[model samples]
Target: MDVQPGPEREDSHVDSDVSASTPLRVALLGAGVVGGAVARHLTERADDMAARVGAPLALVGIAVRRPGRDRSDLGVDPSLVTTDAEQLVTRADLVVEVIGGIEPARSLILRAMEHGASVVTANKALLAEDGPRLYAAAAEHRVDLYYEAAVAGAIPLLRPLRESLAGDEVRKVLGIVNGTTNYVLDKMDTSGAGFEDAVEQAQALGYAEADPTADVEGFDAAAKAAILASLAFHTRVSGSDVHREGITDVTPADVAAAREMDCVVKLLSICERTDAGVSVRVHPAMIPRSHPLAGVRDAFNAVFVEADAAGQLMFYGRGAGGEPTASAVLGDLVAVARHRVGGGLGPGESSYADLPILPMGDAQTRYYVSLDVADRSGVLAKVAAAFAEHNVSIETVRQRMVPDERDGDRHDVGEATGNSNARANLVIVTHAAPDAALSATVESLRTLDVVRGVNSVMRVEGS
Candidate 1:
């Protein structure tokens, strides 16, 4: 950082240049990929960023777990790197937190605001878990807390919902938010790979972590879902409030079944407003190919927002990566820095609506159920009765007969039970109903004597 003379030196006079363009000393937490990109931008594009922020931006320090580690290629002065994140947070006009998770990152950010410095963070877990605390700190301290990168990387999603669409009513927010699961599901859809093989491919390609539980199991997307729902609905929604289902249960049969119905399987983050209240959930769902979110293949992310005045809006782009996430961090840095220099705060948390998060069972949705049934008369009637037992109305039903091993030919499901020994694949699509009712229908089907097995059960969305 540029060594600015302290007022303790008792200078006779200061120039208007120094007064007008005071350097916004920035402390970066986490010298990982995202932090490295942020550092490079501050170093390589200092003049450009300063011009945009109406003040000079200076890196006070880069905090890391190991200051002695080889971050030589990260493009920052060695002297400016330190292990003391606590002290680093105290000594800057703005703090950029890329270190994810709760605990220390949360504590450090709270400390930064307490010390009277604004914060810009991409820590989604911390935000989704306890965002109200951070917002309260910023509001009480009169500081800015901007986190555009927390949701959709560089898509500029949160600002639009938080600012541009602030006047409008957001009815729903559906997205393919987790890149790792999206890549896995997309691979399964296109290459016909099984869930395990697709996940292996995603790990080899760096789309997933060594321990891919967070991404594949939907916890990562759930955190992002909570954040999106909170912003879109003007309510306080936390990670626990969001219903989470993983992609681990997705099978090759599920992928093929989706395609047979002109649909694709995606790990979707869905938030909606119902008559009861708002609902937030993340799960692997079957959506028609015509839907915009279905076309978002591979590791890309897209959020489809439906609002009263804005109608339907789709934000699409690279969802993850160091540089893309840092782009969002830098954007927030400039905005927060401008607020610091110009003497004002940007928007804080707005939970004025304070809508209660509805239970997952109450959310209205459709179901695509695949059943292995005995190839006998009255099988269809018995299955239909199972759905009716739970008040779930079936929209469509089709049967795929299993081929006889004796001859590579399909056996007719309508054939007499004495002549046919094959089981039939009975596919049923249900009309939109309460999720609990649809779930109960699946359970009831499992109990019927005509049903041999429940092959797959997936939610149908985007129609």
Candidate 2:
């Protein structure tokens, strides 16, 4: 696996003496995919890791719920497996946590830090929810708490934002942070598959879970957005602060409409600095094919960051899977191990800016709205009036009659225009408007007698 190390060190703490430095005792929690891979890689690269850190890295023990479950496949020593996770964490100089969730993982990490063990974790949900308290605990104990795997899998994102771009002002962070949603959307774009069919395909391919609520409902990406926004803006943003919209509501019509405008529908986790404050949101939006993010397909991930000094930078790679995610875990493990050997701490939390999260209502973006309405003269004027009423300025409006076969379900009110007894598809693309105003316009359109239904409404993003 290709794993990129963090920024280089200025301290010349390199020691080549094999027997001089004390071996760092490493404890691993969770013998699942990431943890097992970390152990295997640690064992395979023990010699190399010892040389790099100036001390031998020993896997003292692995904490697991089922110690009896055969882990011989991972090459883990059976004697190292233990059920007492608390005891296991206390005996180590450094702990690598891959077990997800908020409870035992959080408590165990805090306890490990108190025992003078620097920690590396890949738990994004926990970090987004209770990061401040963990940071404070690590600071109090003078132990490092590094979590490079919490976002973007193996992309090496957090360190660059925390270190390399520390001097630059990061203006925006836009990413396709969820792999499941990306796969589903890619199917919808390429195969012309509906939401259910695309999701089924993703499941069959093992890209999504049986219960894909976290990925499909946008919760996963929203949590990642919170982490990204906090790092980019130096704010303590949580998942609840982000405005989330899932692809569950996306229809085939939405996908076809994107094609009409030379765009593709993607679920994006976006974080930006606004004049009011910081705005973070996750939603399905249309991006032009020419945009860098549009080409990111399948389970792949990409993040576009715009900084004042550095201009624009794009980080692209495989964002998920156990190996890719384990790669990130290993990177953090190595960095934290080096810091432990040097008796120093890595970068702690830097939420000094403390910017407030802006409300979604105030967020401004363009919109694409498609409506099925009666093919009549006054109907177009009435629909145009709806936009004007909500203070939404329209950039373009195209009206066309639906084919007779497609219009079978649509009822024709009367004959007013040349295409007498046919229902029309009204496509309206708006300029940048407040989210609240665009939402209001859509609601008002539904109330109009001429409009049968609002087929699709998607935000338009990117250049």
* Top-lDDT candidate index: 1
Q: How large is the C-alpha RMSD of every model relative to the true structure?
A: 3.1, 5.2
Candidate 2 lDDT by residue in tens digits, 264-288 = 9999999999778999999999999
lDDT of each: 0.88, 0.85
TM-score of each: 0.95, 0.92
Candidate with best TM-score = 1
TM-score of model 2 vs. true structure:
0.92
Error of 2 at 86 (Å): 0.8
| Collision pairs in model 1 | none
Please give the clash total of every predicted structure, in order: 0, 0
Q: Alpha-carbon error at 251 in model 2, in Å?
A: 1.3
